[model samples]
Target: MTLIDPRNRYPRPPFKTQPQDFPGLSANMGPEPDYGLDSYQSGERLKGLVALITGGDSGIGRAVAIAYAKEGADIALAYLDAEEKDAQNIASSIEAIGRRCLLLPGDIRKKTVCVDWIDETVKKLGGIDILVNNAAFQHPRKDLLDIEDEEWRCHFDTNIHGMFYLTKAALPHLKPGASIINTSSVNTRTPMSILIPYSMTKAAIANFTVSLAGSLVEKGIRVNSVLPGPIWTPFIATGMPAEQHESFGSQAPMGRPGQPAELAGAYVYLADPNNTYTTGALLPVHGGMPQL
Candidate 1:
């Protein structure tokens, strides 16, 4: 196999300061995030499986959905209604690959929405073998004093509560050999002071993954998390403060932000049924950023 240099493989940061409303669209991003549309190679690692991914219309979720579809898995994407255009783009690509793609548009913060999406996936896709809790919400504040109760609750509702609701609703459909992958972050270890609420939710996700893994092991279900570092996603372009954009990922030891495509393989690995022994792992793909 050929190797690509990690540092210079994708676009480096010093990015343009382009901000958008909450839940930004990747298509609007300058130097749009590479979701492996033309790059990732597929080996059918997840063939004959159905996977549901929240936030699957863009960023890391988009990359993972594309990768999984390429690998022969039917995909179900759960994203916000505002991201219709982005969701449609992904659905078209998956359909072109001859795999089924289900677009579920709703706010995952609501338990009803979560349950509906899970039920829809099972009804349409037959069954779900992989569950990816990747949708998240984060708004940075310069100081904790500036953070409001609603802002803090928004982070928890979307990031942590949504995961819980979706996972609980999916539990019935997730049989033996099913894989549950949550999108945690390097913030779990090194909480960013400015993103207190977001960081706290991430830490909770890490603990949730481990505890849930243990709880599901008896049923032959496996749970794990992918803790990504400074990835070049719409989240960076919109969720962060404008002043931070230019040096968005400069703090990483590699001197660059990681592309969403770069994290696809980690998700695939954890979901691959062949790796039965691995569970409750918090795999970090942070461009050599020190999480400790």
Candidate 2:
């Protein structure tokens, strides 16, 4: 599960710069941003593929869905009913790319709903080729004791339990060369101070992705995870406490947060057939977090 190899190494950037000087100057005279949004363009990597993305309504999920559509995949978006406006915007964007987009509103926390989602997607889209389990909910807590039983259960149901349900439901429809990409967070690698329960769910995703990759590889399904560091998304703005939200991803070596567009390439790479040999991997999209 560990991809970091100490024996093989790469150059480390100087760490003594001020926060304002972050993102750093490139080898050329120009300065580079923390994450390269301009460089994260897509080819027709997923042409003819059909992808289902939970949380496809907004944030990184929205970016991935749009990127996949631009790459030539028809999309099925599953999101909570509360995200109607955002979901509609994503669907419109997808359609603008000349790809078909189906928006399904439901609570993924229920097993029945998960099953229904896959069944409906297959019926609407013909078959499922890529499954992206990316919906999650996290509430910041001052202490573990401050977390209510309902909140803990909600985290488990939305983050881990729903992922299990949807993956199981979609398995029969997914064929060889299909990919299942889960969204685990950097919290799994470096646990956050105030996100105890949420961090636990993310860690579970990392373990589950590895376990599922092993179990499904014989069937030729590729399973992997993307552990994002601190991306600036509506999830942070709305999901976390208003006060703590300001400092969301500032502590990373990159100093500033990432944009949604920066994450699109990683998803495109993993979903593409070119990455056939890679599976059971946790690709860190964190801003140069030191690997242990």
TM-score of 2: 0.86
Model 2, 120-171: lDDT tens digits are 9999999999999999988888898999999899999999999999999999
Candidate 2: clashing pairs of residues: none
Each candidate's clash count: 0, 0
lDDT of each: 0.93, 0.80
Which candidate should be chosen as best, given lDDT against the real structure?
Answer: 1
Estimated TM-score for each candidate: 0.98, 0.86
**Tens digit of lDDT per residue, candidate 1, span 1-292?**
7998887887777788898888898878888888998889999999999999999999999999999999999999999999999999999999998899999999999999999999999999898999999999999998999999998899999999999999999999989999999999999999988899999999999999999999999999999999999998889876899899888889998898888988999999999999999999999999888768
Clashing residue pairs in candidate 1, if any?
Answer: none
